[model samples]
Target: MADARSTAAYLCGKLYATLWALGVLGTAAPTPSPLTPGRDESTARFPRDELKRRLAAAGAHMITAKGRGGDRAQAASEVFRSIPDLIPVAGLPQKRYTNQEVLQFSQGCAAQLTTYREKYGSLLH
Candidate 1:
């Protein structure tokens, strides 16, 4: 039998492949909703607004926890990994996000927060 890490990796790979096969891992193309003519439901339901809120909250928490020297990127990554439901879009299982993807998304969120702070000052204050 494969070691625990190898088995986990193998399972994760299979899961990703299955998600792709089901067309759940590609670009979120717009699909018009009959009820909301002219509006793409997929885009409408994306969790961007929620994500921003969560990122800001996480940033605030990190700042409070470590003052100015806190690692916001690492904190954001951990928050996202621990709370997958914070992500707005859906279809794939929560475990679908690989560690790399979580890191990338967290880093992106952290960068966006940094830019916002540079322009508008601290979010918490």
Candidate 2:
């Protein structure tokens, strides 16, 4: 049946999304490997002001930049950037990574988030 097929597809997608969030599909090896094993790239090698300058070079501003308003993907990236490494999630520290690395991890988080929104949002809303 059409309804049955839709339901099954949805369930499979949901399960896949959850597994991906759990990092079953991530690049790094399974847990116990330090998520960020190195020193802070900016602080360790560059001065704080220079680090800010590099982030600005990367198009990040203390004030939100243009063309990003209402763009969920961009907004998700900003949220991800704001996360500190001190915060731990799923047995990983959120810090000590390069901006690029953090952003990559954020893409996975955002995908999982989007999937969750698709799955349970209508019910909760």
Candidate 3:
């Protein structure tokens, strides 16, 4: 099941790029959309130290949290790991990015993903 979700997320990322290329979805214009808080952030470049700080601020612990239906921590980790795949759209020349930029880019990607899900709900399922 985790494998399936991972594959789905990978496919979703690819589909987003395809849609953007086809102009179905907008380009990575770097504009502040409702999903992304643009102006509030300094730049779209989150460093490791900052990332650790942000995670710490969020009270993220190392313990794995599991539930009856599924392991959400694992799922979230999987998603977090997949974030690097979005660097192109985020306009990050390097792997490193700002937390706000990362968040904004993530929000934009998620928004595009939501649109994709709505458009191809049956196909994906």
Candidate 4:
């Protein structure tokens, strides 16, 4: 389960932690989980417009949040470029994934993560 919104949010988080590790950023309060009874956003596939809004929000968080005065905009741009552009109403296909499958997908995504200093964290990319 990894829709555009959730996947973009996950990428934002991965980039944030990378920045933190590079000692160029500060942390803010934790974001509320998109999980709860009767609802799990990770599996939710939103429309194209909504996806764009969510992407904008993620980008704003990266660029506008307190981050040791580093140029986070470039980092955000680089991280987001890993995913397909969210456009077209006939958007991505949805899949209801098992917990383990989701975990594997997330690990795969992390392995392909990009940082400011490298095109990708894993050389296999």
Candidate 5:
């Protein structure tokens, strides 16, 4: 909930989890493990080029949707908000992540996310 504590990787992990649960990332069925864990490249590291495109697109949709209807906590407003609330999501071109950002997403992907899933999985579904 606090900006100080959350990171992009954590947020991206949440995004990836939701996509997986809704059957968006890989199969039409929501299965166990993102991109089949050890099999797919995205399972370990999200495709950098594609992630930016999808994230920007998703962020644009969020802005539009939020403008039309107000937000509830379930929407993970903080993800968009953590877009720093300054940098326009649509203009994310030329963006580069620091080491910290890379590390956080890695943690979100592989480890340290069990508690997050346990705590927030219901809201997501």
Candidate 6:
């Protein structure tokens, strides 16, 4: 169970890192709020914060399932299924992306899934 929790944490960390690298996550520095008209809140949460929160919640669920002697693999799979919802469309004018960007994002997702399988294939049973 401890191993399952550790694996889930590790997987989530890697996914977060990949999202950051792809600019799917917000900038390290907080931007000024348009509502504030020039006042920048260093502690302001960005749109990506919701995605992070969801991921953390999913990780917690994975841990909880393992602790309760449920199928950790199924719990982890549920977390994986929720990942697509993390892609933000809040600020977009339209639900359209450039072809190159879409291709790159798809490739990145494939790579991340491959990494996950490599790391947790045995435990996922």
Which lDDT values do the candidates have, in the order given? 0.33, 0.33, 0.35, 0.38, 0.44, 0.38
| Model 6 Cα lDDT, one tens digit per residue, 12-121 | 33344333222211222432312132441211122234335545565454554445443444535554554654343342113233443333333444456555446545
List runs of model 2 lying over 4 Å from the truth.
1-91, 123-125
What tens-digit string does per-residue lDDT give for candidate 4 at 41-123? 35332222333455545544555533434344444444445434422233432444455444433443343333333642321
lDDT of 2: 0.33
Stretches of candidate 6 off by over 4 Å are: 1-56, 65-95
Residue-by-residue lDDT tens digits, candidate 5, 17-109:
443332321122334565454664443354355445545565544554354443323344543443344222443323445555545555554
How many steric clashes between backbone atoms does each model show? 0, 2, 4, 0, 1, 0
Using Cα atoms with residue i matched to residue i, what is each candidate's TM-score against the true structure? 0.26, 0.26, 0.29, 0.35, 0.40, 0.34
Residue pairs with clashing backbones, model 1: none
Better of 2 and 3 by TM-score: 3
Q: Sort by TM-score, best first: what order?
A: 5, 4, 6, 3, 1, 2
Clashing pairs in 3: 45-97, 45-98, 46-97, 46-98
For model 2, how does the per-residue alpha-carbon lDDT over 8-67 read when each residue is reduced to its tens digit? 222222222333222211212343211224633333222224233333343332123233
lDDT of 3 by residue, 3-120 (tens): 3223332333333322332221122133232223654232234333433343342222213222211333443333334444643443323454445444444445465556645654
The model with the greatest lDDT is: 5
Q: What is candidate 5's local distance difference test score?
A: 0.44
Instruction: Candidate 4: list runs displaced more than 4 Å.
Output: 1-27, 30-56, 62-71, 85-93, 98-100, 113-125
Between prediction 1 and prediction 6, the one with superior lDDT is 6
Worst 10 residues of 1 by lDDT: 18-27
Better of 1 and 5 by lDDT: 5
